[model samples]
Target: MNNFTIYLATLLCLLASKVVGQETFETRAKNIAAKIETITKEEKSALKEEVEAVNNQLEKGSITLEQAENKKKVLAEARAINIEARVGKEQENLKNLVQEKVDGKISESDTIKKSNQLILKWEKGDKKHIAKNEKRTTSQFVFAAGLNNLVTDGKIEDSDFRFLGSHFYELGLTYNSRLAQNSNFLHAKYGLSLMYNNLRPTDNQNFVINGEQTNLETNPIHLKDSRFRNVYLVAPVHLEFDFSGSETKGNKRYFKTHQNVRLGIGGYAGFHLKSKQVLKFDDSNLEATEKSKGDFNTSTFIYGLSSYIGYKETSLYVKYDLNSLFKNNTINQNNISVGIRFDLN
Candidate 1:
């Protein structure tokens, strides 16, 4: 099987196990209650340390997605086992004490009071544990693909643009942090991304850069393909508003990879990594290819404003660069792109 199929199979198995096992949670929790009571405080601390270590590995990208998911399963199972054990032990103790009260070893009033206190204690502990687990933010790698184009200052005819041939793509890692301590509606997302943008001119034209001047020149010969590409290594930060009641806790790590009806607005700044032009044509009936790489007189830096709005993994994305495409070029063509964004958080 392919890697994707294998991963899917493993994930299905894990999820199935959780579902099948969930039905026995009450029984298992009762059975393990005594064992949980026997666990020392130091042992509980050790468990926390182990979970923290796994989280560190995940954040550092040292573990694969499957590995991270498996680790999370292990941690959850440990917590469940601990919770069930404690509840079971408490129930057993309560039963024993009630039996004593029935035998007249304790006063009826005293027995009632003690039983109520025990029940309250269990509820409080369970609530605290559940609250702790719900507040964590999960981190993962993301890959996005989309189309791109340029928005110029002066009038550029639509016929002079090649939208399909000009493609824009990005790959990056993102961390989502809850804006409010108790609410997941607002979030702050920050990450480093490598963005590639290709611009293809229409009407058999190619980019020509001389010193600080950059312009599109029509080819003397018939051209099969003529493309200019710019690459950027940027750090982006966004403020996201999720109206799906998706709660995120900055202090804890939880795995909820996608959101419905989410909107994000952000800006990015980065250095221009490289720029190149490629030309392909038929020379004397023989296919020929030429690639030229240089300073290109393109801007050394790039900054842009970007936004996205969508449901689930796919979203409409728009980005507009504030800076000019070329540093000192005669024509001012700012890079602007509108396309679909796939976010695998």
Candidate 2:
């Protein structure tokens, strides 16, 4: 080969070697940082296990409280010493990397600077590791209120229906089970709720169910109050999605407290706990109230489709019953409700 061609090939080989050396140095720096983290985590875990063992011994009456306390102090001091020793060793390893300079292909100053930057990056990642390990299934309490009504295929001719007093309230405790081990994007949400649904007919009217048929009946006296009430104990289950990102505050830790958008779609099945009606009238300068409690031809089993769309704490809630409001009723009326829901997490 010509002398110029040989020189060009040699230049390319040198350039490739330099690139590989730089990559190797960076990789080794990351490995060292990762090893240091793993060793420290293992040591902390051992210390926790030691403390737990001491507690177990004390609980079993094998050691007195004072002795257990002393043992805990000893274990803590030992852990501190272990950590100090490991940290010193890590520093020594880094110093050796700076001194050796990886076969002198890279300068010692450049190696130290690059290694320091890599170590800082890995240190920041430690918080992410901790968050991943700590994250798990969680739960929160919820409250909801809205307007409710019975929509039917048949209609009552002489009654004027209104939505003012036809309100519903629900209180529940909900739990979220994560679908993936290290993710909170998709979760299985389930909860137990107590629901109260009320409907008031306009123009002094009361609900009356005759045998298997249900309808609203008008009253002759000027009725001051008339309403129908039903209570339910339900278990709701849904698939909930959280569209929120993690943020770091003043501290270098990541938190997921701000869920900006959330959606839950699911169904619920419940049992009718009770059904009642109240009536009041003024007669001959006397005011009297009467209450009736019975099945009222209402369905005992309740199942429905429920959903909510939320931004932050407040959400619009909706529920539609699949079955008729009253069992074996001719009118075939179903209940529907819409309202707002709040999450207290």
Candidate 3:
């Protein structure tokens, strides 16, 4: 009689487990259906709002009717694609849930929690919303370093500064704004930058200020190193052309600049911040260093034309100053530089 009792209890337990498993599966399936419906509704509402915005633009004459229609079509197609993709992902989750149940990986006690977590994951992983909300203006950090020299009387060969020793560096923040509401091909880039231009004279020469003129003269101490540096705070403006393609997500398209081949033409204007000279020499078998701060007759105002051609974030950059390097001198000398530039976004 005890054996029969044990068998009956085991049978009851098996039936109860089957019933609970069936209930769990039913509950998860219902939750998946509801989540899919919610996703569709959200995308549809967003699409409606976007369409309304296009209509308003058309009414305001900001965009023509034909353009508005084209925009609406593109938006609709994008939204439809988003809905299809998101819903397909939810369906995949449901399939995985069934597979987990078949493999006995899911427990009845945690089924509801797991299903809720899956829905939450779907919400968090949706990148379409983020892509659709891209801003019209973006900012990036700019850094440039390269060879520095001067063009004396419009001739580079007559430069007094060492070709390889002289260097220039720039640091700044820039903003890029799309020129058109719908196109990313053209943009206006503007920013402020701090520029450092260093010149190392060749042939044991050092800069000497005589009266109103700054001239390079032979140093009597047989100098090992002599450098003159000028600092400037400048504002630069450029019209940039970006060839990177646009990406469509949901109801909007975003143009990411500096992702491909780009060309920029611009100019800058500012004033000299300060100037200093450094000298290092051997004096009586001892190393001596001298630092002198002065204007050195350097120009107080700075203006230059700059340009760049590049792929992605790095580019070949060149700039030439329009103003004279010195305030009063017999010969006109202008600073020039060529280097690699990076735009860190």
Candidate 4:
């Protein structure tokens, strides 16, 4: 048989040995006392194995004799403490079991039920123990992707960029801090993010840099694809209102967020990292691709207004750049995006 099967058989046999019919209070108390003895024996046996391993390391010159002695001392003390704690816990259980038996709160059949429960606990690992103190600030990963376009002189309809083809994406980390000690209604959310914005012209047009202006003009070749992209590293902050409420536990209150409806109004400011343009077309019946990286008179610093509204981790998001897309254009244009945002805690 495999080791797991053998281990399970041993547990079953140990439990079977404890099974009894119509046990008196004294008998149950004796069983718990026997378990305390077993705990001590198990811890001592484990200590013996650890000491043997330490001795083997010393013999192999992997550890000095003094080191081995120190390790043995620590292991012995740890095992002794473990035995005392385990036995003390069992003794308390014994006291409770006996008291409950006398008070008629526990029946004879409960002994078997308790034994089964112990076996189940042995099969499955113990549940994790959580601390009482909770942190006030938590972090989450932010990701957003959606359609990107440009608004010219505060008009989206007059924009030259194609609405369907343009796109924007943002990836970052954000921290949410509760503004009030006992309320979950408000939070200050802030983070650093990288933003990517791409704009594709409506016609077969590509950006041309004039002496002092960046303008769109028809490509000489039949353009298969033409795109202008800008990358920015920005720090965003928001005042987020969460309607998730709070829960009380043992004289302390814990505020919860991103569990219900949430609204965030924020803005970001950052410097432009890069701007590039890409063009692909047929050159003399052969497919050709061209890439150009330059400032293209685009703004050096970028700041934008952004907001989101939705339930839980996901929300409908929108952002609009306040600065002009290009510095010296005849009519100023600003980048804008609309999409879905996800905050993964």
After TM-score superposition, the amount by which residue 15's alpha carbon in candidate 4 deviates from its true location, in angstroms, is 42
| Residue 274 CA displacement from its true place in model 4, Å | 0.3
Model 1 lDDT-worst window of ten? 17-26
Off by over 4 Å in 4: 1-133, 283-286
Q: Cα RMSD to native, each candidate?
A: 19.3, 25.2, 24.2, 22.8
Ranking of candidates on TM-score, top first? 3, 4, 1, 2
lDDT (C-alpha) at residue 265 in model 1: 98
Ranking, lDDT, top scorer first: 3, 4, 2, 1
Candidate 1 lDDT, 257-300, residue by residue in tens = 34468899999997675678999986677588889976588776
**TM-score, every prediction:** 0.59, 0.58, 0.63, 0.62
Give all candidates' CA lDDT scores.
Answer: 0.64, 0.69, 0.77, 0.75
Best by lDDT: 3
Model 3, span 1-345: residue lDDT tens: 232233233223322332434446655554664565567567767978999999999999999988997687567557755765786676576566556656777576675565566557546854653543366687665668789999999899967789999999876668888888888899999976768899999988989999999999998886889999888767899999999868875565767777799999999997775688999997677589899977788887899999999988778999999999998998999999999787655
By the TM-score metric, which is better: model 2 or model 4? Answer: 4
The global Cα lDDT (0 to 1) of model 2 is 0.69
lDDT: which is higher, 1 or 4? 4
| RMSD of candidate 1 to true structure, Å | 19.3
